[model samples]
Target: MTNEKKKNTITWIALVLLTILSWKFSESLSGKMGLMVVILASITKFFGVSLQFLELKKAHSFWKFGLLGFLVIFYFLVFLFFS
Candidate 1:
């Protein structure tokens, strides 16, 4: 496979693993770890969606970066809410 395809596959695999691990250990894990996992998963999902959209539309850099920033802030808010 091409390098880009390989990278995307790996990223998807990692996202799935993180999602499962976060769910599995959420109750037993420390609060901080749980929060971190949730944040990471959220960020991963956000980037995955944003990149896919950008690729499809050949979107401008500003929009991609703006979406990323929004995702980061959204994750922060989610963490705070859970905490």
Candidate 2:
């Protein structure tokens, strides 16, 4: 297979696995650890989507880092104030 197709297939598999794992965590985990796990999983999936599906991997460094910074700040704020 082509390299690009291979990369996409791997990413898609990872996304599916992460989704299933997150759902399992929802059922088994609890409290702060659970919240952290969920958030990490969500952000991981978000990153994958942004990179692979949203086509952000080729984005300018400024926009890329800016989005990453925003995501970090958002995660901290939500975790800090809400949990």
Candidate 3:
């Protein structure tokens, strides 16, 4: 397979594994631990889909970092408000 296809395959596998792990965490865990694990998985999947599937990897640095900054602020706000 081509290099691009390889990357996609790897990313897809990663996302699947993360999903399953998060699901199990949600089932067996609770409180802050479960929330943190699910949130971490969500953030990883967000970046993976954004960079690979949404073609954000090739985006200008400004736009790329803008998304990162947005996520940071959003999560920060969430933690602040929830905590």
Top-lDDT structure, candidate number: 2
Where model 1 places Cα greater than 4 Å from the true spot, the runs are 52-58
Candidate 3: tens digits of C-alpha lDDT, residues 1-83: 99888989899999999999999998998877777777788889989888987889999999999997799688767766655
Instruction: TM-score winner between 1 and 2, please give it.
Output: 2
Q: After superposition, how far is residue 9 of candidate 1 from its true place, in Å?
A: 1.8
What tens digits encode model 1's per-residue C-alpha lDDT throughout 1-83?
Answer: 98778867876787678778777777677787877876786677667755753362267878766777777887888888888
Better of 2 and 3 by TM-score: 2
**In model 3, where is the ten-residue run with the lowest total lDDT?**
74-83
Query: On a 0 to 100 scale, what is the lDDT of residue 48 in model 3?
Result: 87
Write down the TM-score of every candidate.
0.71, 0.89, 0.87
Candidate 2 weakest ten by summed lDDT: 46-55
Give the C-alpha miss distance for residue 47 in model 1, angstroms. 1.8
TM-score, ranked from best to worst: 2, 3, 1
Best-first order by lDDT: 2, 3, 1
